[model samples]
Target: MNILAIESSCDDTSASVLSGDRILSNVIASQSVHIKFGGVVPELASRAHQQTISQTVEQALEEAGISLSDLDAVAVTQGPGLMGSLLVGVCFTKGLALANDLPIIGVNHMDAHIYANFIEHQPEFPLISLTVSGGHTQLELVREPFDHEILGKTRDDAAGEAFDKIGKVLGLPYPAGPEIDKLSKQGDPDFHDFPQALLHEGLDFSFSGLKTSVLYYTQDQTNDFLEEHKADICASVSKAISEVLIKKLERAVDQTGVKTVVLSGGVSANSMLRAKTEEMANRKGLNWYAPHISYCTDNAAMIAITAKFMAQRGRYADLEMRPFASV
Candidate 1:
């Protein structure tokens, strides 16, 4: 079946066309207005989505060599994101469904992240997924397709959030996770040992303490000192976060006895985290999977692929369905 998917759960307005499990095209319109604000502004994001969603979808369809009438169903991210931003996609999708007499599939943003790995790889069942993003950090046990048991999640700030917050203290740009990852490659991870909160605790994670630690650590240093050791600081912080995430994932694997492990969400794009996950999986003789970098961040291809699974299960949404802000 051919599917048209829209993703506007955050600052990006994206659309994708999928046939079976293959993505023909994935188009994203990112809003630069939030860069100066250091984070996404809900109002601005919704406005940008409204402005670009139509054209984004058009581009996706054109690239796919198909039109709206040829689509079998329309899918969209329904929740676990900004309400206004979600509404832009949800309402727009509803209109298309109504006009073309097509079925509407409502997808969870987090769920889409997990399934994004399926776009290129066929991971075995009964797997553990470590989903790390700016808004969430979670360990999910998937016993089968679309069957997820959240093993643990962040009690406070997520891993990606920690990266950005700490990066800001180091005077990096907004959405600084990628920046930190790049700089860490050239520095020493052992330069400074940042606290890894709840490292020995339960499956739940915490990064708030780490954020505060970076804040205080930077305050005590002069600008020249910070500039001189910026890469080291970034490397150390990345080490702390990656250690906590990998440790928790290891615990989940032991507790669940799952041989296959997958990583998803925006933070999964980090080079250090990917390498650490691969190393741990190899040491344990387990299977490891992660999405291509294109699917790591927010995108409609994940939504389209996830919707294909949902469609198989006869999960469909009606016009009365409304957008939600949380899971």
Candidate 2:
């Protein structure tokens, strides 16, 4: 079946065309209005989606060498994102589905992230997924397709949130996770020790304390000191976050004995975390999987792939369905 998927759960307006598990085209238009704000503004995101979603879907279909009439179903992110942003995709999809007489498949943003690993890699069942993003950090146990048991999640700030918050404290740009990752490669991870909260605790994670620590630490330093050791600071912060994530993943593997482990979500694009995950999996002789960088963040390809699975099971959404803000 050919599916057209839309994702507007956050600042990005993306659309994708998929046939079965293969993505023909994935188009994402990100909003730059939030850059100066140092974080996403829900209203601005909604407006941006409204402005670009139509063209994004058009580009996706054109690139896929198909039109709306060729699509078998229309899929969209239904929840776990900004309400206004979700509404833009959901409503737009509903209109398209209604006009084209196509079935509408509602997808969970978080679920899409996990299933993104399946886009190119066929991970076996009974797997553990570490999903880290700006809005969420979670450990999920998937015993089978579409069956997920959340082992743990962040109680406060997520790993990506911590990266951005800390980056702001260091005077970097907004959405600073990628920036921090790039700088960390040239610096020393052991230059400064940052606290890893709840490192020995249960499966749950916490990065709020770490953000606070970075804030206070930077306050005590001079401007010259910060500029001189910016790379080291980023490296040290990345080390602390990656160590905590790997440690928790190890605990989950020991507790569940799952041989297959997957990483997903925006923060999964972190080079250090990806390397650490590979190292840990190799040492334990386990299978590891992650999506291509294109699918790591909010993209419609993941939603389209996930909807393919749901469609196979005859799952479809009603025209009256509404968008939600959380899982």
Candidate 3:
């Protein structure tokens, strides 16, 4: 089945066309406006989605060599994202489905990230999944193709949020995770020791304290101090964050005895996360799956294919599903 998907749950305005599990075309229009503010502005994000979603969908359809009428179903992200962003996609998708008389599927933003593993590669059932992104960090045991029992998740700010907060303290650009990942490779990973917040059982993570650690470390420091240790600090902070995650992943694997581990979401693009994950998986004789850097962040292809997965299960949502602004 051909699925038309839209993802505007955050700063990215994206559209994609998928045939079965294969993505025919995916177009993402990221908002540069957020860069000027050092963070995402929800009000502005919804407005941007309204302006760009139409063109993005058109582009995706063009690239896929199909029109809206040719689509079997329309899929849209319904929650766990910016309300303004989510509404733009939901409302637009609902209107399109009504106009074309097509079925609509509501996809969870986080679940779409998990299914990202299915788009590029398929692993055996009962695998451990670690989803790291700007808004979420979770460890789940995906026992079946569509069933996810969340094991551990962030109790406060997510890992990507730490990157942005630290980036602000370090005077880097908005969306700091990628910037930190790119720069950390050039310096020492052990320059400074940052605290790792170990939470209670069930895989709950907390990055709020870590973000505060960076804040306190840079407190009362001159610009020269920051400039001199920029790379090292990036390496240090990246090191601390990655270390905590790998430790948790190792525990998850051991606890579940699942040899297959899949990584998804935005922060999964971190070089340290990738390197450490590979090392950890290899040493344990387990299989690890991570999507390409581009797909690690938000995009519509994941949503489209996830919708296809749901369709096979006879799972579809009506227009009643609502949009949320925050976690």
* Clash pairs (backbone) in predicted model 2: none
lDDT digits (tens) for residues 112-155 of candidate 1? 99999999999999899999999999999999888999999999
Q: Write the per-residue lDDT of candidate 3 for residues 1-327, one digit (tens) a residue.
A: 999999999999999999866799999999999898999999999899999999999999999998877889999988789887898999999999999999999988888898888888888889998999888888989999778898888889989888999999899999888889888998798898899888334467888998998899888678898899899999999998888888898999988899999999998888889899999999999999988777889999989878988899989988787886554
Q: Show where candidate 3 strays beyond 4 Å.
A: 199-202, 325-327
RMSD of each: 0.6, 0.7, 1.5
* lDDT for each residue of candidate 2 in 245-292, tens digit (9 for 90 to 100): 999999999999999999999999999999999999999999999999
Ten residues in a row with the worst lDDT in model 2? 15-24
- Evaluated at residue 28, the lDDT of candidate 1 is 93
Cα error of candidate 3 at position 159, Å = 0.5
TM-score of candidate 2 relative to the true fold:
0.99
- Supply candidate 1's per-residue lDDT for 144: 88
